[model samples]
Target: MKPRSLVSQSPTSLKLTTGCEALDACLRGGFPCNSLTEIVAESGCGKTQLCLQLSLRAQLPISNGGLNGSSLYLHSELPFPFRRLHQLSKSFHLSNPNIYADHNDNPCDHVFVQNVHSVDHLLDVMPKIDSFVKSSRTRLPLKLIVLDSVAALFRSEFENTPGDLRKRSSLFFKVSGKLKRLADRFGLVVVITNQVTDFVESSDGLSGLRIGNLRGLYSSGRRVVPALGLAWANCVNSRVFISRSGDGICEERREDDESGSSSVGRRDRRRFDIVFSPYLPASSCEFVITREGICGVG
Candidate 1:
């Protein structure tokens, strides 16, 4: 009997591209597999756009900055944006014909979209993805799982109920444990987007500033913190923040436009910051959401 080699038995070392160059560079390649990366930001800060782009990017071959695997997207706050995803796919395929030539076969086929409304719905559906290892014989096993806006369901069911704080805390740990297990066992990249809440002023006067300051749409000149509190915060492996730096309006700024203007109406002057990560350093870079996909602007 031959002994198993360390390379073969060892877990896969791969960096899932975030579908954005500057973002990936900030993340030291991209969101690392076998961990949970939380993308937290205020509403309309390109959180969903990044998630949508990732669904497609995860389907590409590793040579083209993908895991060559499928994804499971748990949509919570909004309906699945298939139209925007289609636009991104079309844009990428046209730019790299040879790479995405089999474009007729959409990556959406491999990517599963689940609309979860309540905690019950989420708990019921999540375990099903684990069954793929046994039932899936032909397709690539699941590699990525994204939960957009993890705070919506719990905020309604858990936070509001009287004396349910403990329950809510435990519930989060349960879900987090499952996700951590799935990530470690299956080498899946679990990325979750969390909504933000107004930062409560503390006696120290540093409550808002300590968490991370944003001068964007929802900031309203007052800082905000990621919702779901400390219990939910302890579960995530990486937390990335998205915010608009200048003008706070998210629009495209094209220099070649008919008007000889310089960054006139572009609102998407966004920043991607790696708040904390064991493997990746704390850094930030700017990117824009264009028709094609998330691209490094500066």
Candidate 2:
């Protein structure tokens, strides 16, 4: 073989469009294939909304910035939002009429969902996905694998003791390893959502290792950080954060008012930030959740 330096450049990894222009731009294209991306956020900040949009976006043709494939969503808690998904499907179809013009199938029908109740259940499910993708019966190639929330299974499964912590970290590696293998084998884009906990400032240096933008882990004027600590942080290739902030303004405020304020209303102003990523710098953009879907604001 020729020396390593003389080898040809590798092909660029595939990216799945987020369907939001500003957010997509901030992501420097979109969520990348062959890597694990973590979406960290507090409750009610549109984490699931963004994931729902991606499920539909993945079905678009490759020319339209999609993978032209299907998505598998492994949700850890709560019922799958079938009704909301149907609503977004309508919006997605309207947004891309030409893409679906030749086909009559519902895009929402293509998203496969499974609830993972515990750590064991998730571990059991991961190995089987490889076979599912390779099965000839699958009509569409799988491009996206989303774990709606990774923190739920571990929240109560392990205690804070040293032995349990080691076990928890070991399990983390197992799941991430399998996901990475699948990503590399199939050029898949894996997106995992994580819950956030209130950050408690400690003089000890251990707390300083928490990840976020350079300004620290404050969201919505309150300090918060992704759950599962640093052990889980090392498992992913990228981390994106979603947050909300506002005063008493109406939640449905359409645009920035005459007061020259960017915020909508109470809990209306939402922001998306790149906490850390191998391919993207720490950047941020604003976004809104409308009846249609999540759209990035200027």
Candidate 3:
């Protein structure tokens, strides 16, 4: 008789928190554990806020769709705004006093943060991040690892010439593959933020500009091309886009004819749209960001 096979069944389910019930439903519970997910968008589009919220949500218990683990937040361009993070944490009711008590302890002991500006620096720091995760005393599974804007590395490290583009593209692919492997080995959710470039076409029939040359050129297009182009989207399991929309102005009007003397001012509320997803239907939902956190709006 042939020897019995040793392989066992894979886990049938994985749970995660989308930071909002509606989003969780859309995601069919949450993002897959031990996988990579890309969240790409332009500035002021709630990308960082979503990441911060997810980091807090990861601390919740497994039954609540969280990983019951810690998080690692890597910053590429801007340092983390502690004040904003604190405010958001308060809004979400996720503040932990104990984690703040020990000021001298390594930040990786629970929630870790690292600042890396260049691709070379990020490559150098990867081993250190692995070491920190391995040395945690609590043995709390690291549920989330976030790279706040991965495109910054490429933009800063590589030139725009064809040779440099090819070289950088290959490097990014290799690095992304390594990250995927790391997530699988550690059973952690890896979230990467990416910046986008505009796909412009001039009237003369030119094949779009290679690079824009103007003030605020980087913010012209939605941050999807860099995040989702060149097989990058295929490497990750899911993608999300967040954007804001409003009337951009406020006006005053009388609420009722009876109250002739009083005028009411109406400020348009912000809107949240889910532009794309792999596991959920393509639909948009309205939400408001308030002191109570992200709440569904009619």
RMSDs, each prediction? 4.3, 3.3, 6.8
Q: Give lDDT tens digits, candidate 2, residues 1-298.
A: 7564423645556799898899989988899989999999998889999999898899888888998899999998688888989999997888788765666667876799999999899989988998889983645699999998899888879999999999999999998999999998888999999998888777886666646565567677787878998999999999998887734345435445545565445466578889889889888888888888888776
Which has the better lDDT: candidate 2, or candidate 3? 2
Please estimate how well model 3 matches the true structure, expressed as its whole-model Cα lDDT: 0.63
Using TM-score, rank the candidates from best to worst: 2, 1, 3
Supply candidate 1's per-residue lDDT for 84: 87
lDDT of 1 by residue, 208-254 (tens): 44432333213434467788877787889888888765443323434
lDDT of each: 0.76, 0.84, 0.63
Q: Whose TM-score is greatest here? A: 2
Candidate 2 deviation (Cα RMSD): 3.3
lDDT of 3 by residue, 12-41 (tens): 346677667666665667777777777666
Worst 10 residues of 1 by lDDT: 211-220
**Model 3 misplacement above 4 A:** 1-12, 91-109, 202-228, 250-278
Off by over 4 Å in 1: 1-12, 96-104, 160-162, 202-221, 246-266
TM-score of 2: 0.90
Cα-based TM-score, every candidate: 0.84, 0.90, 0.75
lDDT, model 2, position 51: 93
In model 1, what lDDT does residue 125 have? 79
Candidate no. 1 TM-score: 0.84
